[model samples]
Target: MKTSRQNIEIEKGHAFVTIGMFDGVHRGHMCLVNNVVKLAGDTGGISVAVTFEPHPRMLLSGGDINLRFLTSLHEKEYLLARAGLDHLLVLDFNDQLRMMSACDFVERVLVGMLGMKHLIVGYDHHFGYGGNVNSTTLDDCAGRHGFDVSRVDALVDGDVSVSSTLIRQLLEEGELGRANSLLGYEYILKGRVVEGKKIGRKMGYPTANIEPDWQFKLIPADGVYAVEVTTGENLYKAMLYIGTRPTLETGGNRVIEANLFGFDGDLYGKDLTIFFKHRIRGDMKFSSSELLSKQIAKDKDETLQLLG
Candidate 1:
């Protein structure tokens, strides 16, 4: 797929377009994307997905919010390309676009820039000047611009509808399995291994300390989890720990540490991604180091069983 960043004069064509932040690119978002691609392909039009960078909230909130995200810009681009879309346009959510009304957005972007023949969106999606646009507003815009508009129903995962917001909530609540199901993939945290105190090494469970690549990427709640660690071209089953080492003397800042099973090599300064699979247990404070070590062994066994 072709990608174009801000300020490019797009050559207008018969295009089928959808616009959104598409955070997490969850199953619900994918449903709408698939429709856009299929509609464009069936009618011989270009499939275009217009997404904003840095999130509208980061800019609109005046940078006062501590916002976290599921997927980084690069990850989103890869996912969109995998969805088989023709074009991925990354727009800046600047003052000009933020202040524009629904009519102006439809005229300037969907009509003037893309020459969109059809517009697709998810059920609850609304946008333009404080989310003033919805299915009703889009229909009105389509009448003016002579473009067809379609809205896909919400995709349900188990009992609840799949959504980026819901997935974030699940992760924050330490429900990794449910969140992964909603995402249609594992929740991944990519980072570089950093130097850490040898607490785990002394316990005979050496771990690689991770510093996440994106500062605003969301970290799952404190817990012991079953995960798959990927580095270079190799993957390994691992038990991940996310919390302060309360059993140790130094228990302050939260840390992410993963113990790779049956592997031993230098990992500092290398990039790694942890694909969270299952939540083994919540963070707890043990009475002594021996007790904590014993609990760690149990966690590892449970993680290995889950992998099997």
Candidate 2:
């Protein structure tokens, strides 16, 4: 449960470690973690996970900042803890660590810093500077380091490999049901409910707006979703909207808005976690505000039924 910024000496004991950025910790990642935990249990080693912060992609490419995220650090930690892991090592993704060669990474970070006796990586394990390291190199390195390696077989369901990218694609395509199935849980996005133009309220569909911590947190496709809204304490069945308001005569600014069904309470400036259950409809351009309002009502009813 200890989170350290400076490197801590790897406790002098055997440990099973799973390595990845683990952005969403979706089904595939969970598989790896579970495998490590089970293996560690058999080997009398600690179950540990190594993940990077500020996703390496963001550090590598300063691309579009608004990619929606499936989970925040707090969410990831909570999920991992629930999965029965013993330790979660969140390393800072910085240039210094990035420069380490594959061999050095295995020796210094995984072995020296983590004291991993068994290393469990995904089927396609690649790491080190420029990602030039592969499975062969890892096997050789493990042999030299006197540790065990477990390469988890690819986790696939028919045409789809359970992956963070696949989950992101599903979300982008508004495939909430399929995405949730692959994720093994509801796909959630964490953000603080912030102030917004009072457009939804004026239209009689008040919204609790969300502003995520990372701009690059990948958002699902622009659509209305059946959602469960949690503001750290209370959970509510609701309709969540993620899109630019086309009906409102305004500049196109993408926004995340959620309408809690049959619940009225102040949510301004509070953090909210939205769990997407199903996609109801794609964002649309209505002929009139009245038309948009009518559609919103229908969306609400659909979401209510979905929750039920």
Best by lDDT: 1
lDDT of each residue in 1-308, candidate 2, tens digit only? 44455565556557788888776888898889999889888877788888888778767877446555677777788888888888888888889988999999999888888777888888887889988788788889989988888888889887878988888888888888888898889877878988888789988988988897656677889999999988778889989888988888567899999998777888888888888888999999998999999999999888888899
**Worst ten in a row by lDDT for model 2:** 1-10
The collision pairs in model 2 are 65-215, 65-216, 67-216, 67-217, 67-218, 68-217, 68-218, 68-219, 69-217, 69-218
The estimated TM-scores of all candidates read 0.95, 0.93
**Residue 221 in model 1: shift from native, Å?**
1.2
For 186-257, candidate 1 gives per-residue lDDT tens digits of: 999999999999789999999999999998899999999999999989999999999988878565899999
Q: Which residue pairs show collisions in model 1?
A: none
Q: Over 4 Å off in model 2, which ranges?
A: 8-10, 62-69
TM-score of 2: 0.93
In angstroms, give how far residue 66 of model 1 lies from its true place: 1.9
* Candidate 1 Cα misplacement greater than 4 A, ranges: 7-11
lDDT of 1 at 24: 94
